[model samples]
Target chain A: MTPEQENQIRESFDHQSMMTTFGASLDDLTPGTCRISAPILDGNQQQHGFGHAALTFGLGDTAAGYAAMSVMEPGHEVLTAEIKISLVSPAKGYRLIAEGTVLRAGRRLITVEAKVFAKDAGENRLIAVLLGTMVPVKPKPTAT
Target chain B: MTPEQENQIRESFDHQSMMTTFGASLDDLTPGTCRISAPILDGNQQQHGFGHAALTFGLGDTAAGYAAMSVMEPGHEVLTAEIKISLVSPAKGYRLIAEGTVLRAGRRLITVEAKVFAKDAGENRLIAVLLGTMVPVKPKPTAT
Candidate 1:
């Protein structure tokens, strides 16, 4: 990816307050691919003290959206049109990592997928997989 | 729904820290339906100052899970196997409400769906719809 494109993705990601709330960070970026990780916190757990599926889905969705954005034209933004996720295993770990890849990039719709892994003691276990479609749109005008 | 069943659902929900972090509340419950709502907080927003898709999906998923739980046998719990969501409109509003219902209940897997609405100025607009499968499981033993 061009330096300008990388800068754009980082700037856009910085504006997402949800990522901040979850303590998620962008770990890597490349053309049509993105990786994100977040530590598992007590506030993000389900009844059984495992990482909530919402946490998994949130990270995966954002990572996938950024992957689509990476391949889009300058100043273009992407929005999720639809997403599906399957929980393959319990998320029992200290942190979660999501790797997203673009399957197809079109003028209007982009297909993306993400694999989420739970990391415990440096071991990673696959926990969930997500597939989604993103729509490219011109950035909305900022308030003056 | 029986009072015992309602109490069981409420107690189970109270154990979910993710719901507490989102400030989501169980608003209603019946034999095979559940409703949940949460205010749109600044911490849960996307880059465009709108409600994040994570918030919508979290509410919908939990509501649908609870709907499945409402009809399960005693000592049984439900976990999401897979879920798919379509964002029909931008989530721009004061709060989001998700109403979930069981489409079909079975011994192993239950089919469920949820409709999410964005509420602003006492008006509601359809924002998203979700379909999912829930698997019934015996409650895990708590730590002694």
Candidate 2:
């Protein structure tokens, strides 16, 4: 990634509000890769005694979005244009870990894959796997 | 749509803990078709004074899932394996309306497309468009 791209990625990561909702943050983000974490909340539970699908989805999306952004040009913003998540196991835990890898990066779109896992009860099971497509747009040029 | 599939779609629609969480019903679902509504809620707002992305994505996924389910057999289930939502406008105060259409239905995966809109001040503007892939699974046969 270009130096300008790295700064843009950092700025983008810092401006997100959804992270506050999930208590999630980027642990490590580099060109083509990223790791995200969040703690489950009481509101994340469903009647089936697992984290709601929406919460898991949100975390997975974040990881994929950031990973895609990491690989983009400096001043380009990555927006999720499409994604798929497969739930493999119940999410019953305090913390969720999401790691995303860039599969294909193009001028217009980036494809990212992510896996979400829960750590609790001394067992770590994959909760969800996500496939996301991100669109990249040039940032508005400075007025100066 | 098969009669068995219709019944299964109804069953999926009927199983909801938060009944008020969604607007409309099975009557609104059809293969390559859908209708969805979301009530106005203060908690569903984002910083842009519009509905949260979570709410929009949930409604979009439900519509797509149900639309896919409407084309399957009674004992089968349609699970959302992938989705992509783009935000074009702020959610605003209007009730959200979503329409999901089947793009392709294959033996392994069904692709559905969804559009989200809001009746903003009596005008509907596209907010997000999502493409989803729904996976179908077989159901157990009845006991003899």
Candidate 3:
């Protein structure tokens, strides 16, 4: 993907409401992969000080969406068709990172996988795994 | 489920950070079933004025968790082990509702499903579906 394409994807993340609500941000974007990260905020945690699964899932799914977008053409956007996430371990850390990779990219359909890791004091532990399918679509009229 | 059990789950939802952040509320709780609802807010929508996928997923997953909790013993809580959500249609509405039902309850795991509906002008449309595995866990020390 070109730099313009990458910038386009990043800008869309700005319009994603749940990402902002969870204090999440897009960290990296490559040809067929993306990384989204969020802090373990006091207002976004569950009972055990672990990152709430909802927030974790949001970051992971957004990463998958952007990863799929990275592989598509610039004018086209992507929407999630389906997403599955399994929590392997409790995410208790200062920050969480979701790394998404496109497994297959078809004309209309794309399959992506994201792995979320919890980083505490420079040590990272795998916390969750996500699998999703994204579909390319024309830009919405309201695209900001 | 007993009234005592319902109250316990209700109290727990009060402490769930993400639910509060999303302005979500538990609308109903019964044995093997739950309903969670949230309003469409400007800070939590996607490009088309639809509720962001993450917000919808969070509502669905919380309903699934509470549904499983309702069927379990009083001192036992539930956590999401795995979750899958499929976006069937765009959610353009004033409010979103997720109704969750338990499919099976096992010794250690419970399977549940949630259907998300978007309501506009008193008309409702199915927008998404969620399936989840919830595992029973001991109550946290701070649980009310």
Candidate 4:
């Protein structure tokens, strides 16, 4: 990705308050790919003291969404139309890492997939997988 | 649902710290059904100022999981196996309410669905829909 394109994606991600709430960060960005990571904290745990499914879904969705956004034109943002996730393993770890990849980029719809891994003590275990479609939308005109 | 069943569901929900982090509450519970609500706070917004999709998915998934749990045997809990969510509209409202129902209850897997509504000025608009499967699990033995 170009420097300008990377900067655009970074700026947009920075404006998302939900990421701040989860303490998630954009770890890497390349054309048609993205990676995001978040630490496991007490606040994002389920009743069993494991990372919540919502946390897993959140990071995966955002990572995949940004992967779609990376290929969009300037001023075009992507919104999730639908997403499906499968929790394969219990999320017991110190942190979670999500890797997103774009399968196809079309004019209106983009197909993306994300794999989430639970990282503990230098080991990573696959916990979840996500597939989704995103729609690109141009920014609305501002009132004069 | 019996009083004991209600208590079990409520107690389990109370122990989930992710719900507390989202400022969500369990609104109602009946046999094979559940409802959850959360306000649209600033901390849970996307870059466009609308309620983040993660918040909507979280509420819907939790409500559906609880609905499945309501029908399970005592000392049994439900965990999400797979979930699919469709965001039909932007979440711009005072709060989001998710209503969950069981489509089928089986020995191991329960099929569930949830409809999320955005409440604005006391009017509710459909924002998202979710379908998922939950697996019933017995508590593990505790060490003496």
Candidate 5:
């Protein structure tokens, strides 16, 4: 994807309300890849003082969608069809990172993978792995 | 599981932050089963106006965890270990519901399945299915 396309994707992501609710931000973007990060907040902590699994999954899922969108044409959009996430370890940290990469990009469907990391004490620890399928759809007309 | 255990599980679910963030609530609770529902909001929607997949998965995953918890001992809690969700149809609706049932309840690991439904115009449409594993753990003392 070109720099212009990347900016477009970023702009679209900004329109997603879930990102604002969770305070997640796009950290990096490249061809067929993207990363999202968020600082750990009390609102997202579970009973164990660890990051909630759903919050982690949401970040990873969004990153995977962007990774697939990074390779699509300007007039197309990507949506998640399915996803599987395995929590490898408890996520206790100052911030969380989700790095997504497209494994295969096809005409209609793109398969992607993501790795979730927790940054604590200046060290990043692997926390989860995710696999997802994203489908390209016709662009929705911009709202008036 | 007894009725007392079911009520205990319900109390725990009420404390989940994701549920509060998305306005989801526990609709029904039974032995080895649970149902969660939420009114569709713009914050949980995608570009095409369909409910976002991550929101749906989060509901289903939490229901699955509660399904397992319902069968556990009083002092234990269940946490999501892994999950696989397949979206069968686009979710367009006024309300979303997720039904979860335990497939197996072992000493430490439990397997569960959940179905997500979208209620629109007085009709319920199946949108996704999720298979998940939950691990039972000793309850952690809440921080003061």
Candidate 6:
């Protein structure tokens, strides 16, 4: 897809939706890469007063999903078939950024990896990592 | 760990701190085995209005983590090192149950499998499945 078309497709992810209810936004997207960010909020706090594990994982998956979608065909859609998010460090900060890339693309599935970094005290720390599989929807043949 | 202590630890993972927060309470615990369950909530919806993929993974990982803890010796703790959750169906339902089992227990890590099922209009649907690795923490010796 052309750069203009790719930008339009990235816009369709709707980062403001519930999956990103805590204020997530996509900053960049390309053929096989994506970057999203979210600001930490009191509402997202767990007992630890840090970003909840659930929220952290959500952000990472969103990045990975978008990364896979960027490389897929225009008519093809990608959905998570499987995923794994590992919490490496507690997320305690004002903002977090997730960078994701497509590791492999296949006919039926795509593999992606995402890493989340939290901005803390003006320093960035790796907080989480995610690996996931995205399954592409098969297009139905059009009858002429 | 003693069977009695195991019971208490299992219960702790279940008590909810908030209505939106659901947890799997330990219903049963034995060496190398554990069972827990939690209800699904709309607030946990992902971008597609289905149960969030990350939440599903967390539940699976928690189940696997606790199951690994059940079989560890006293003073040992368990943490999820890695997890893979498969989303088979849209997690539409009232409740989701995850049954976890220890597939292989090693001195350093334990492998566990979790099956997530949702009750859909009185029919059971396999919504997700998970495989996780739990790292065991050994107690440190105190200086005399």
TM-scores of chain A in all candidate models: 0.95, 0.88, 0.93, 0.95, 0.94, 0.87
Looking at model 5, residue A121 earns an lDDT score of 95
With a 3 Å backbone cut-off (N, CA, C), the pairs that clash in candidate 2 are: A5-A74, A82-B84, A83-B83, A84-B82, B50-B92
Per-residue lDDT of model 6, residues A34-71, tens digit only: 88888876555543356766567777887888788887
Q: Once superposed on the true structure, which residue ranges of model 2 sit more than 4 Å away at CA? A: A1-11, A140-144, B1-35, B39-53, B66-95, B100-113, B131-144
**Model 4: number of backbone collisions:** 0
User: What DockQ results do all the predictions give, each relative to the true complex?
Assistant: 0.69, 0.19, 0.63, 0.63, 0.50, 0.25
- TM-score between model 5 and native: 0.92
Tens digits of per-residue lDDT, candidate 4, B1-144, equal 678878989998999888998899999999999999999888888887888898999999999999999998877878899999999999988899999999999999999999999998888999999999999988788611
lDDT over C-alpha atoms for residue A30 of model 4 = 90
Instruction: Name the regions of candidate 5 deviating beyond 4 angstroms.
Output: A140-144, B140-144
Sequence-dependent TM-score of model 1: 0.97
**lDDT at residue A9 of model 1 (Cα atoms):** 88
Q: Number of clashing residue pairs in every model?
A: 0, 5, 0, 0, 0, 0
In model 1, the runs with Cα more than 4 Å from the true position are: A142-144, B142-144
Better of 2 and 4 by lDDT: 4
Ranking by DockQ: 1, 3, 4, 5, 6, 2
Better candidate number, 2 or 6, judged by TM-score: 6
Error of 4 at B47 (Å): 0.6
- Model 2 agreement with the true structure over A80-109: per-residue lDDT tens digits: 676777777757777889899999998888
Instruction: Give model 2's TM-score versus the native structure.
Output: 0.67
Per candidate, native contacts kept equal 0.78, 0.18, 0.70, 0.73, 0.41, 0.31
Model 6 iRMSD vs. native: 6.9
What's the TM-score of each model vs. the native? Answer: 0.97, 0.67, 0.95, 0.96, 0.92, 0.78
Would you give me the overall lDDT of model 4? 0.91
Q: Which stretches of candidate 3 lie over 4 Å from their true place?
A: A142-144, B140-144
- List model 5 lDDT by residue over B68-135, tens digit each: 99988876778789999998988788889999999999998999999999999999999999998999
lDDT of the structure predicted as candidate 3: 0.88
